[model samples]
Target: MNREPKAKSQEPQTSGRSDTGRSERAKRAEGLPFASERLTFLEHLTVERGLSRHTVEAYGRDLEYFAEHCHERGLALPPQIDEDCVVAFGPYLASKRGLQPVSIARALAAARTFLKFLAGEGVLPADPSALVSRPKLWRRLPDVLSQEDAATLCEAPEAEAQAGGRLSWRDRAILELFYASGLRVSELCDLKLADLDFQMGIVRVTGKGSKTRVVPVGRDALETLRRYVALLRPKFAGPKDEDRLFLSRTGRPLDRIAVWALVKRHGRVAGIPGDYSPHTLRHSFATHLLEGGANLRAVQEMLGHANISTTELYTHVDAKRLLAVHAQFHPRG
Candidate 1:
């Protein structure tokens, strides 16, 4: 990854520090119960996932609220969390905090995602989030490209690559890898040249919370990547480029924004509808894999999802398949 430029030294803060938005949150959450764990998760969101400042602060505040609730109840959390800890959260939100239904639901959702991450890290024995009843809102499935649409998008850059277009090789490789590996945009951008193992047909990805996973690269994407490395990458390599597998025209490592723009431009060229982004390719990758009868656990690991519950999201939306199974297996049927 391209190193962020160091900030110039600034004046030291006064004895009486002015605690603003994030500072105030930290000051409050700092002394609260479970502050250590909460701070670690917030750091994970900021550093690993590269979430925006406001977004990380939002999560920090929401988690602070949860911590306060637990503290008030004298609930023993961490090293173990059970249904009781999760079960009481909704009532505490509604009655004690007097949060509206929507606000309460949002908190629960955030907490659920957070807890799942902890569980995946083995910090918690199990995720207790599922014990609480979720607000029965419509589940929005991810925007997924059909296989034909995905093929069109992945193939869209070939003409440009063939015509000696600038960075077309890089673009082709990125698109193919996006479809093949089901990587989060952040994970994809974090990849290094050392991560790829063509002999093994795998790439090592460092994902959220600094967790690493190995995902198989399809033959097409792997071959394209080899060509990009041999033919194009050297041309773009700068002294500071280091081991980054992907580089910008300036020889700096590619960031998430570049990947998004690349996917959007290619989506338009492919004439696919609904403003697909890099995430669309990721969603499609998981969707296609599961639809191809890929095991749930395998997909969970490949996508670098902290929790299998997330991987299960792609499966749950297949209503027709669920119904077919019911009809086939039920004794009454």
Candidate 2:
């Protein structure tokens, strides 16, 4: 595996802070609940993934939120997470913090993705988020759901997982991975079997301009992917679909349009209001991470953006939430 290259300096300069001061902060971060892991995850994105500065900062905020949430609920480490913790966090974000459904969903998604990361890195025995479904947000609008409606949508996939069919398994795998890794429709359609690295829980993607990057796939998605590859893909595949990750009933590779249609179909079936496209999933993937405090550069890298400015477009999507924060905290407001 290719690792991040370290930089060499011609000259070294010392800051006013002493080594003891640096050690103290490191110790303090380690002592805090989930702080060390959070820092390591962010560093992985930075040094290992080559994510942009803005993306790293966003992830830092999201990790801090997770740490704070875990600290509040007395969840000191990954092992402490269970289905209840996952479920309860949603309500706490809603009722306690008065966050909108979109924000709440974003937070849960981030936590789910983060736990998957920990599990991949062997920090946890298994992915606790596997059984816990991601909270879905309405397209274009942050349409709020009744408590019951939210629960139903969340568990709908779990129910489907229990009553599995070849198509069901394949669809679930595709959808889970779409949100998990935030792949472009084209990138997703072009995926080959050889690209998946289950041990690392990542997929090597060739994005726009033929630039390739390896992105971490969340644990829950990886689980579904295993099932899809082992059982489902072979069922639908002909010689044409042999190497492709996704395929149609005719055993041909699926096109981008097919993926888009699948997302829309699933979104509607889940009772999610408004229309959805494959990019809708992509938008949600980036938006949720940012909303959860992912670094802007990390998101950009994951999305295979050539320029940081393109990724900044997602920040604009948070205008309302930004205004809400300003209203609550701004002295003049």
Best by lDDT: 1
Summed backbone clashes in each candidate are 0, 12
What is the C-alpha local distance difference test score of candidate 2? 0.71
lDDT tens per residue, model 1, 1-333: 222121101112222343465477677878777777887888888888887555676687778778887777776567545678777788888988898877777888778878888888888887888667777755567888889999999998876666556667888899999999988887887789999999999999987656688899999999999999999899889876568899876577777766787788777877888868888889889988888888989989889877888888899655545687889999975
Candidate 1 backbone clash number? 0
lDDT of 2 by residue, 1-333 (tens): 221111012112222344566576556556668877887787877787776454565566555566666778888877897777777778777776788887677667777777888999999988887897677655444222333443333334554455432366777787778777888787898899899999989999987546799999988889989988987688777765478888766577776556666665556668877655666667777877888799999999999887998788888776766898899999986
lDDT of each: 0.79, 0.71
lDDT of 1: 0.79
True-vs-predicted CA distance for residue 160, candidate 1, Å: 2.4
Error of 1 at 118 (Å): 18
Q: Candidate 2, residue 42: CA error in Å? A: 41
